[model samples]
Target: MGREDFERMARAGFIERNGTVVGDYDPRLLELLRAMDLAADLPELWDLFDLMKAVPLLVVRGEHSRLFSRETVATMKARHAAMEAVEVGGQGHAPFLETAGLPEKILEFAQRFASSVRAEAPSS
Candidate 1:
């Protein structure tokens, strides 16, 4: 069922030409990969979810994303009653927040969850 959608994403016609970056592909690609090896000491943050349970949670995912699967989203929703999840259609791996109506959705979420709270000005 998702084959046509997947193929549409793969075809050259699917790419937005105006957004294309004209570059020498190979060397920059190698540099990007090499940069990852410099981060051996990065801290693991998978358990941070437990710490965030006290706050309202919002998860935005790409419909075609392999890294963040629907099953994982379902499990997270099952665990957190306050969690809100939305999948942006026709996107993969990561959706550009500026492209989709993501900014509006995120803004709505913030209003719903945080509008009631106010930060007090610090005493001088």
Candidate 2:
């Protein structure tokens, strides 16, 4: 967005500054922006409630991360009943990169989730 447009949106309460919200030069920023622009407050998925009801969700958190709070996790669970939250041990924002064994932990979580998904499927 142009500076003028962004400024106007900010003034109108449609957008606000997200100061250093993510790690510096986080490549995920662009992927996230492409998926959904937080500044616009746009709804990427129209039937979010419906989808939430149909799917299981896992929310992993860094123990010391400031990006999301306990309240946010609670709200997320309230919104989607099938949500699971995991906290990485002894780390802060971007713990998966900062802490040792993080990759293993994440991979284990993924494997378990996948196994559960397959188990839940109806047998042909």
Best by lDDT: 1
TM-score of each: 0.57, 0.47
Q: How many Å off is the CA of 4 in candidate 1?
A: 19
Q: Over the full model, what C-alpha lDDT does candidate 1 score relative to the true structure?
A: 0.74
Backbone clashes in each candidate structure, one number apiece? 0, 0
- Kindly provide the TM-score of model 2 when superposed on the true structure, using C-alpha atoms: 0.47
List residue ranges in candidate 2 displaced over 4 A.
1-50, 97-108, 120-124
lDDT of 2 at 94: 46
Q: How close is each model in CA RMSD to the real structure?
A: 6.7, 12.5
List clashing residue pairs in candidate 1.
none
Question: lDDT tens string, model 1, 49-121?
Answer: 6677778889989898999999988878877778999898888777656557899999999987665454434
> What lDDT does candidate 1 reach at residue 20?
75
Tens digit of per-residue lDDT, candidate 2, span 15-96: 2238533333446667866887567765655256546766666777777779867787787778788777777765555444
**How accurate locally is residue 86 in candidate 1, as Cα lDDT from 0 to 100?**
87
Per-residue lDDT of 101 in model 2:
62
Task: Point out where model 1 deviates above 4 Å.
Answer: 1-47, 119-124
Quick one: best TM-score, which candidate? 1
